[model samples]
Target chain A: MSQSVNDLRVTRSQRFIREALIDLIEERGFDALSVGEITARAMVSRATFYRHYRDKYDLVEQIYAEAMQALFGAIAVQETVHSPQIWVTFFDHVAEYDRLYGALLGEKGSPWFVRKMRTSLINLIKEFGRAAPQWQSDSAHPISLYPAEDDLIPDVIATMFVEAITWWLEHGKPFPPQEMARRGVALVGAIFKETSTW
Target chain B: MSQSVNDLRVTRSQRFIREALIDLIEERGFDALSVGEITARAMVSRATFYRHYRDKYDLVEQIYAEAMQALFGAIAVQETVHSPQIWVTFFDHVAEYDRLYGALLGEKGSPWFVRKMRTSLINLIKEFGRAAPQWQSDSAHPISLYPAEDDLIPDVIATMFVEAITWWLEHGKPFPPQEMARRGVALVGAIFKETSTW
Candidate 1:
């Protein structure tokens, strides 16, 4: 087979394995399921499984990364400073992964999912800080004085947003996703506003 | 032996087992450790170990519960609110279990530990909601409403606070513990303030 065809085959196999693992996990908890079971379910050879993933944990991480990338990608960046549209985009983005997010953040969810989400959010904030010149302006007072230096601000805010969303999910998400997202955006905005003043 | 004396003996043995397990986790990492190893290290019989804990996971959960109880007990509750004092108390409480918290929330921490923390936090929040009266007010708007239903605000806030703290620990606590606690108080306070107005 040509190199491109081999690559496509490999990708297809990886996707098959990942989907199988998720199905297995949903049926049996992550701890209860063994990797041999995963391979058997995927109808793949042990060698193929090992070649694609170091272990079940690695495969889980890969699935989480794909979910995060897809979630982040859905949120289009604002070319201009329009807070409401940005908020709407943010809500829509979160809604895209609501099912995965619910499973990952639910009572029976894996801690690896939360950890992956936290890391992704931190990276996203750092990327935003680097790309947005407004984050560097002195007009913001305390925040301006310590933009990159106070990386904790973004980390804390991101954490709060994620936790609030998780809380909503585990408790049945009483409000519409858009409404929850709106509240989340407002909460973070209030936090940043306070910190900048401080 | 007297009933109290027998109780004391059982408690001491349990403590010894838990301490041994923690030491093993610190040295070998939680994933690498086993129930047999914990029993051997604690100098207790496998029967005794089983009597005290169903499994390694159960033992870890007990340790987590003890740490949380100690931390929560350390916080002083008053009839009237004093935000800064409350924050100071909360930080001091968390500092008491810094080692366990650090091990659980640190980069090299165990997945089991992290999951235990999240579950405990959720339970704690539910308990708080059950105990807090202000959460039941009907005037609160949907935008300002606490995530939990009537009398569940405390539980919701507690979960949110713990999740934020856990995230901070995993991502590298950028701010001092006191500052983080203060921020937590402020976040909860804002939610309450908004609800009252609504």
Candidate 2:
């Protein structure tokens, strides 16, 4: 009972800090942000802040790490790998924290964050490719149709996925998660056909 | 005769300065670089550098502007609008200055450059769409298949195109210009088919 109470306190404090950071970043960008401002905004003491995060960068990093882990975890538990539901889950996760993501991926955000997202997306894609050989063997996707010697397909798809999300978020997400997922799947399918014909 | 000589000298000085900027950016990134270092490396005096550019940012901006202008100019001259030759000219132009582009779009480069590239590509795409309605009317491409009310297709395609180039350059460009062109076209064509069937 005591441990559960402690965990709840920790979660609440972290959420406050994270929300504060997102609001501040959206207003003034990450570079100009400071710990004092974040703590003040979150109504938390400096000691409390330090207890949770090493610094602002560490705070942002932890937030991204936790969010991405949660996202991937959700996708992992899906009944089928690389299903349309995967994209739906991915976009839904993004939409859940739309404001935070928009700020992180906007012009105000750091390039380091963008690069981190790209790397994570690429690894996720490669993992999908491994788990489902049929995704490639069945010619269901364009990435699978690449020549054996060419290894840039993953990079290409990852880039596209990241940029699409960035563009969507930057534009205020004109489409809902389901719509985005549909368009995304259609894009990959289109690429597959183009590759096979070529 | 004197005017032509002055023009030649001006062009030579700008080239030296631009090359110096690329080399310095590749080595230490844009932030760590200084105007003094650029001028010293170019073997030009401060006065000569200022005569050609206001500052480092201006210099970088002008370099991209000229390169993009040259690329669009080449594409504009193509006998057929949206022809395969356009991609060939683009990839070829990129290959001609592979080192410069790689440096600009690489990890060390600024986000400002990436944003600029995205906007330029989006505009270029819109221009093509305007010049040739058949590109869409005949259902020849995926972008054309997008519902008239949906405007995100240009953004999606632009993001994909920009990110793909960035990835290719970062990966040391595994394929030649012609090959890259073919693959790029195939990717676009694939998206078309996906959109049509969806």
DockQ of every candidate structure: 0.29, 0.45
Model 2 docking tier (incorrect/acceptable/medium/high) = acceptable
Best by DockQ: 2
Candidate 1 docking band: acceptable
TM-score of each: 0.71, 0.78
Clash list (residue pairs), candidate 2? A190-B190, A191-B190, B142-B192
Error of 2 at A158 (Å): 1.8
Interface RMSD of each: 3.7, 2.4
True contacts kept of each: 0.21, 0.62
- Give the per-residue lDDT digits (tens) of candidate 1, residues B1-198: 235656875887788897787677667777777888988998888888887788887887787777667666664453423334555665666666666666655655676675556555555444443344453454445333444343334444554565566556555666777777677656665555444442
Which ranges of candidate 2 are over 4 A from the true structure?
Answer: A1-17, A31-56, A130-150, A170-175, A196-198, B1-16, B31-55, B129-150, B170-174
RMSD vs true structure, all candidates = 5.3, 5.0
lDDT of 1 at B147: 46
